[model samples]
Target: MTIPQAQREAAELLARLSGAAPVETHISAVYVGRDTAWKMKKAVALGFLDFTSLAERERFCRRELELNQPHAPGLYRDVVPLTRGPDGRLREGGDGPAVEWVLRMAPVPAGDFLDEIAAREGLPPRLLDAVADAVAAMHAAAPRAETDPPAAMAAILDGNVPSALRAGLDPGRVRAWAAAARAELARVAPALAARGAAGFVRRCHGDLHLGNFCLWEGRPTPFDALEFDEALARIDVGYDLAFLLMDLDLRLGRAAANRVLNRYVARGGDAGLLVGLPLWLSLRAMIRAHVEGTRGRDWSVLLTAAEAHLAPAATRLVAVGGLQGTGKSTLARALAPALGRCPGALVLRSDEIRKRRFGVAPEARLPAAAYAEGVSAAVHAEMFAMAATALAAGQAVVLDAVFLDPGHRAQAEAVARAAGVRFDGIWLEAPLEILRARLAARHGDASDANEAVLLRAAAVDPGAMAWHRVAADDGAAAAARSAIGMKGHSMC
Candidate 1:
């Protein structure tokens, strides 16, 4: 709907009086009031429609406040009636009459914007923790939705493809990428379908990019959700989390994204969503690039920048290797976000992929059929293929594997060379006593190797890979910091 002339005039007046008000490019007009802000959607009919009638707008105004307030208390304000006198003059709470309704929102400080904070100074650990906690709480509080992920994705993907093609992009390449994305999604459809059935689906903040998040009183808050459709906002927790992962891949660290994932999983104790994250993240990035490009002229730069960042980031593959119980998984989890700090970095864990392929849980033992010579070869072959595919596309990749055999090491090196990305072999080894204690205390662990595997592998010469060893101790984090070239905290 086009913004009514009166609304536009009112917005201009509001902007003049308030310090925070500004005319946003995507929306028709936005302005700040004394304690809150307002956005008046243009009357233009795009792929998504807004309230057309005055009464409809009033209803939407109330719903926006109702929906956002529960999660973002002290952030959203009541939608107050805007009165226009009989003489056709509009004013806030005028005695004359009710002309329309404005969706009011509590004003937040400008410095609270995460993107602004990240651009100026890399995100602080405290903020990262806050954001993770906020989203976890949001997911926990949300009610489950009935729709499945694939069908929801299809509609969104269809809606986004046209805009991407229309942005004077290569249609053939876009089409090919879309096909690849769809195939990846299909591969994980069963897991996604189960999430939908198990009531993991909920009303989420559909667009969870950095810009929509802010810190108020030292806590991360999500605002301005997709109010138009319940299906868009209502989704699997993994889908909601994928937005942040994609955003992190686009800007901060892949290791950080991994850390975020691990923290969320540790809190919720659900890794079921792991398989769906990468595919969903890719789609989310693609859709965002398209939306920014098509929405307005000012957004062209955002589109170009996102295309450049995401095109390569979509491919980074990480190769991880360490003996069982030496903290290979822990270090890999830690390293993921660091590698992802650079755009186009993706970490593919062998454990997760292996479990997915063999129809076993991460902790389940593999059957003989699943680990026969041919089957083992096939698993590695597929993993290498995935790693290479992501890397060839200019993404930084981390592959987590035991690298027990010299042959596996060679294959991984060949992939790095073929893809022209630097390869780092990380060997995490602990003291014999530490390994013994770690293995002995394990209860229902995912790692197949126990004391026997550790004892055997410890004796077998880890000969050639000796140069890459990182000692596991209290200083383990320091070793990791050195491996990644991150400067240590300075004493002010």
Candidate 2:
């Protein structure tokens, strides 16, 4: 329950390890003795959680095992009980009462942690998309928990705001922002309650930051989920995700954060949850601000970041059109983070839409009939409808498709006009051979188009090249940068 007690016990326990000593954090000490590692919770009580007793420690240990099993399988396994026998010797798991509880887990590659990787290489578009996909899947599979929406939010505000005030921010400003946040949550309480009723709330990874996610087997797997408090972890999916979004925006830039959000929403994130995103993101920033303050770090930077993310961006429509090998999707993704709100724009790619329409994976090979005129028309119509809705609701959108036909291109522009938003179109052009090579090299991608599709698209008579034509033979970097005026994804 006290600091000295925890320190002494951890020291004695870590002394038994044969290899390197364990690493210490605020709550836990992790010993990497051999191939396996042991995580032992400190016997301390905080305002949020209490692991003062052996039984309390054991219960939370089990919770870490249960809640983390979905996204972090093979990492969290077997809660080891450090017990005392009749002879007074300490060992793991026995009939005697557990003096302490340690969660034994498989060691992940220390060098490949997402945070470390991002710090070095900066999370590329593909990896960021993969993280979004993983988070979306985790949210989809996590079961909901019934929670009182207003009261739950109020608790966070009351508990964390004081800490934020102590972080060198003016009391008046903190109070004013806190009041505004509470009022906003009240206005959207019904939507939040509905989301909870719909099973959006669940046992989520409470502490889902870059540090917790590691690149294992070339895929990002999130580990060390929150286990101490169910009330904090069992929340609406958007709130659970807002932490990562805020974290990314702080560590990277808003564009990087926006990319993650857009991708997550594309992969079945609840559209309804967006209404409360600002508050969730603000709360997350406040927590970070206070935590940094406690460590005697200048947390004002986080305050600036919090304000920027909370402020919404203007919405518009951007469409990238080209043949199969013109790198239309790549340009759209680059430009998507540049336009509209945080985490950029909603990327509604026709290839992804077509795959969904066909009820097949992105890599599935569809028959020729799948790309028939009727099928092609349906894809364009659906993409426009979705884009129109997002634009109307004040969200920026990027439509990626082969608008080789004049009619399809006109229709896309018409959709933007109907939504009363400014529309910008970029048409990419490259040699047929280049297109063919790009298509041949593609694998496991959302686009199912092959060399045949490329040739067919090249043969089409796209009347009157009116849109901003860019030579994509040498890649669309210069053109993309010129069009969007993006600083090119600034990372922290």
Candidate 3:
């Protein structure tokens, strides 16, 4: 049968089964029923993929089930064969000769899709955090892949420029972006190689944008991962994450993007990933620009964003220090989103680092022994090292800790100085009674401090405080931003 004939038959069958028109994409059609949905790949041979043969379709149908089931088990049900009997009537599953294959999945509410949610009601901070957690968990469990990071990235750049030009984007802008991207790739090649050697390269969701996620079991679950191309999906985790970050920045706002970036890194993502973020973000935006342009949509904004990603931005270090419950973390989070680059600075919190040192979650409480002088010293050292690494990568750093020791505070300044970036320190101060009350009410926090711990910290005479002392109140973040010479409202 001709390809068009097969396509028509599949659509008719799905429509009959679903009792409604099917949703169509360039490559596939999905029929949504009351509780279930069936997806069938079209019998068309695109340059990147060809699903014209029944055998090929069956193989990819099973491949889709394998790739997505582990990530969203509740949504990806199974791959079933559409077979024909002796009478030549098509049925979903049987022992007859198979004509086509379909992937069955649990139907999700349209409003529950992340993109739909973003359009109807902006993504809340809590939901955004959950999205970060979900992506981080998937990355942590992904098996590492062997590939040349620099070469893989170079290939993407090579493919994108011509595609953008062909899709009717301005040739001048596309060419300019190509030159800047190549230069950036050359600059970060060594770092990318090192990240690959350190096993940061892995099999990741190639299309990790907001539209590829849905609310499943009351949590944001990623689905419809790019399953047809292994080379495209097997990539650096940082590159995989860039798609989501770029999407959030373009759709929601930079503040939302900043929250996800910080949360992902805090959940054990390598801070070194920031080294190539500019290039990765630009590449993702360029892809969207061309895809939209090809469809005759408004893609000028995306093209402009692609150029902006390569524009240089100044990096700096900002440290927020205070006793427990002085709201050092709160102020740090509030100030981080506007600090440096598009997604803002990386907030390195001592409490979170200490928890990581103990091989526990951020909110997991540690024993008293875990906070001994030696352990505390190690935590501070790691925090400073991470700050230096991020600074060297041209990403701003935010140190969140109680600088009870003057030496630690000095080291924070020294890291910035070594990186040749400006440094600013803000000391938060709050009433003793308020500190005790706040510490008492805290739960599920990274800091294990309590009333007793707060008292001990308060007793220490933090020796002639020299940093900008700001009152810990509702305006603390604004005051800190102003003190740091930043002229903008807080984004967090």
Candidate 4:
């Protein structure tokens, strides 16, 4: 923890900027270097990060440039040879023998960093859209690697846990949380690895956070990626994107978090990437909590209660069954915003779940190849899992899907039973005329159902249901409220 002499000298030099520079408080030694900052590896020999020699630093610097140039094109200066002058001063270019090498960078504006701006404004919708777009672009541009992402992720958790404990957090509580997270990761590893094999894991900004992003000419720009380890940067895109999503949810509110996630998923056109979001967001929130606690920053005030904000409030989940284009998703959407009034209520739509499984947005028109028998099965499994997980964790999950098949209905009922929670099905019915009209006029919908799909779905049996019936032509809010009223509850 001792400040090295080199860092001390760098601090002194930074105070002597040529022109008037922005004044700041709590300036890091890393920031106080020459006008063009010199970034050396923090050394890798320590089993964590060892950059012992100039050669290693040069190698990692190239990796940094290779990984970040596309995203931070203007800021990452070229890797330059660092040499000492005749007067023993480290200079970029001077008549002296080379002593070391480092990656130089164009300094970012102090006030433009997203953390400073968002902390002040709490992440406006425009900024959220920009962040979502930036992340989607990064996911598209990042390269995939054939490596074990789980092992790499475990190492990060291991390092962070000890640091948190050392910083005076309750060790028992930390271990308990870590154990739960590890258990969930084990359950999902096969799915994650499968996605990775299918080209979802990629080179990412290993240390993505608000501080790592800044506004440059009205665009969100990312910089200062983890330069030392390719393993750190190579990860499932969901795990990578989860950092930002979870951070937003913790720092802002659920509504904004959901909006940003919707925007990101819409732009990326990948619904499969979202399956791991709940778990990843949970892990990310825990990581941020540990980091804040360890780094002497007060983040507890910003984070929601781990238990209260854990999942959408489901206290009791009720599955709603109906044909496609019969207003299933509309009812779910109306219920979701209202669920917000009750601590936490999140409606996990089957349409959205289906689109995500095929790696496309729900609104995107996909070919039949995208929904092969196997894909169909996978999508249903995901829907069941999402609802079960949320409901089990004490959140109300309104499953929005066409229950044309009895088996799908059975599986959902089984989840409700196993969770020991009350479950009900709200069946919606609309005449063929009503269905066609609704489908024809529907635009900007997240569901992929078309008039033909609805016509085909309308023929399936509604099956016996412990259900309440509602008409689709009636106002969705009124129907939804009526359904709740039938259960002796008030939607308002």
Candidate 5:
């Protein structure tokens, strides 16, 4: 790709200021200095975007700052000009006619970029949780958009094919994938429209992937939002999240992807969004396939991933029930990544539901009245309802709760039966001493139960337990997996 003369001059000017070479992409060049980085939009006319004019670049530079500043804070500073002084020398932020524009940002350490971190140490569970929290936070604050989601999706599908073919992908495969994707979109069109009306459509981070995230201020922060096109940036939050999910599935593994998905939902992402996840993931995979093809890289794996996203998967509901401190939530989370679809099961915990019911964070403590019999019943009911909703969407679900009341256990099974899916119940058990110690050590947990609650729960006979009884120990996950007949299955 030839560097246009104007962009070349701008890059050179930025390089001089930064004392480093510019990192070039198709549409922009970034020069990282000791304390700052300057990003200059290339003077080019790609079919999807046109930044050829100086005025247009300046406008987009400002737009980029405006879109990303709130999410990244001090990282996105301001848009400055590359000016031509009377001496005919190009200068950065000079008082002369502006020749080009650049977005200035705080310099991010190369190793802090999520993609580099993934490549080096791999994403740890804590970091993956943080990543999900960051995305959920962004979605919560995103401005709602009124665009027709179905039409927006259709337009994206239509735009992908020609570019994919032009990038030398197999024409037949591209067309077939497009056809299947369109069919899936048609099937879910009503759900998409309903979600749009409910305000799930928003101006989102248009290009959410590992490469665009970095550790800033010791937290995973998203940056470099797609700025050139408002149409691309405005989308369903689920679709925005899908890019990162797809990237994680491909780069890290399905387990990592599953962790992020469950964590995101736990942080208040709508479970209803699961209905369109397969289609969204397929589209994201296809985007990567063509982008890689264009860069003269092997895109076959990504193409295969695109096809796999639309493949049907078995769905079931698994219930993990036990008294407080038996580690039901732990086992449920461990088992969820292996169940059902790519990113795995949604774990609906009664504790988290109860917290949400009272408009509190998961770790917030509630008054005794909040856990009264009536409140507990309502929490169980909400958990079952959420499970049913997810199962109906062809997603697997794991219910995490203490089903001390036989009635609640029966209701859980009934929900699965109604959804026409298989159900497995695992009852975790532990000695009173062990349970007491576990409860006593709990901190910042959703469960408010302590030794007193544990002793009380222990005194109540969970009548005629018919579920698989597994010892609540380090091997609990393995025992639960075996009891569920998942011995040979590959975990996500």
Candidate 6:
């Protein structure tokens, strides 16, 4: 696509700040300088998004600043107007009638973007739990919409299909997928309408993905939210979250995707949302396929895979056990997606459960009594109860805890047996010194285990263990393979 004259002029003026060049997406042109980034909207009209006039662009820029600040603090700066000075030369932030507008932002570390990090690391890291936590908090704080969500969503889906066809996708495939999706939507329309009325529809980050997130001082900050259309951006919160979940399932693996969904649900998001997940997943997948397809890229594969995720899979129960830092939670998370269904299995972590039981934040440290023998039993009982309930409902389950007692391990097995599902017990272990070192490095985690806890756990003897024993001295990937072997596959 050729650059329009107005954008060309804007670029020439943007270069005046620094000699750096500008990067362009379909909707906006972004120029990244040494310490800052300037994003100028393309004064063009896409069918769904319009920025045909200077005033409209400026309004959106200001809205972008206002909308993104609460979720990504310190990331979005002022909306600077591109204007002409007394001289004929166009200048940014000049004192004259504004010619255009750009949202100024603090430059983020390029390498810290989650997609780039995932590419290099070759596995989904545990930090994803933090990402899920961040999103849950953001959703909780977002304002609910007053419109009818079913109508809003139906309109968006209607637009997405035609967009895909216009983008040169195989018309037959697009038609089939769209029809199925619409039928499903129609079937669930009542639930969608009710969820919206119940405050589930909200102004949300409409385009959430690993690619849109970056690390700021070791914390994941989501940016570049959809700002073009209010109708598109404000809808069911599950639909907003489905984008991230679908991306993770497609790119990373099902386990990775499941971790985010299960993590979000465990972190106080409505577990009932899972009932509508298939439709939400279909909608997000269709939108993604349409976006890429319209760009003359093949998107049929995504449509196919996401459609399959809509189908139910046989449920199984997997239990992962070890002392803290033995990589139990990490392995369990990595193994989840490949286990049963679409987004994978629900991992019930004991630490997060204990925190919930105490009505405290996951990162909040609890007192020593919280770990007393009686208290620990109660926590395990609650975790198993939740896991069993989900399993009984045909959702796959993975219970993550030390399972230090024979009775505790037996109870996990019993839950699966009573549910008539296959069960696998995994035991992760490493040298005491290694466990101590790993525990000491923990920072800002739900697990409050420290070196003292590690030493105490090491002293206990877990007798008559019948589970598969796996050495976890290696890193996360190796530990994961040791636990689940070749059982994991991304839902392609």
Q: Which is better, 2 or 5, measured by lDDT?
A: 5
lDDT by candidate, in order shown: 0.66, 0.77, 0.89, 0.65, 0.90, 0.79
In terms of TM-score, how similar is model 6 to the real structure? 0.81
- In terms of lDDT, model 1 sits at 0.66
Per-residue lDDT of model 6, residues 146-194, tens digit only: 9886677678778877777777777887787777777777876887788
Q: Write the per-residue lDDT of candidate 4 for residues 1-492, one digit (tens) a residue.
A: 432354444333333432333233221124324456545443336564656665776677787777777788777777776566777766664556545555667766677889888788777766776787788888888777787756666676667678767666666766876676676567666766777788988877877777888887689987767766677778888778777766665557555666565566556545566445555666666667766776788745423333223343336666777877688866664555344222234566666666666666556677767657687778778777766665544445677777767888888889889888777677888888888888888876666678888777777666676577888765755776666653313332
lDDT by residue for model 1 (288-326), tens: 667655654444443443343333232333455767777
What range of 10 consecutive residues in model 5 has the weakest lDDT sum? Answer: 483-492
For 1-492, candidate 3 gives per-residue lDDT tens digits of: 122575677678878888878777888889998978999888888899999888998999998888889989879999888887677888788897777889999989889999999999999988998899899999998999999999999999999988998899999999989999999999999999999999999999899999999999999999998889999998999999999999999999888998899878888848889998999999999999999999999899999988988888889999999999999888888888787777888999999999888878788889999999999999898999889889988888899999988998899889999999999999999899999888888887889998888888888988887899999988897788888898885422
Residue 346 of model 6 has an lDDT of 81
Clashes of each: 33, 1, 0, 15, 0, 2
TM-score-sorted candidate list, best first = 3, 5, 2, 6, 1, 4
Deviation in Å, model 3, residue 7 alpha carbon: 2.8
Task: State the lDDT of candidate 5 residue by residue for 1-492, as single tens digits.
Answer: 456885677777788889998788888888899999998888899888999888998899998899899999999999988788878988877888787888999999899999999999899988998899899989999999989999999999899899899989999999999999999999999999999999999999999999999999999999999988889989999999999999999999888998899878877838999999999999999999999999999999999989888888889999999989999988988898888887889989888888888977677899989999999988888888888889988999999999998998899999999999999999999988888888888897889898878888888988988899999999999898899988644642
- Return the TM-score for each candidate structure: 0.65, 0.88, 0.97, 0.64, 0.96, 0.81
Q: For candidate 3, what is the total of clashing residue pairs?
A: 0
Question: Which pairs of residues clash in candidate 2, taking residues 3 or more apart in a chain or in different chains?
Answer: 258-343
Q: How accurate is candidate 3 locally (lDDT)?
A: 0.89
Off by over 4 Å in 4: 1-3, 7-47, 86-88, 100-102, 149-160, 297-492
Model 3 scores worst on lDDT over the 10 consecutive residues at 1-10
Error of 6 at 488 (Å): 6.8
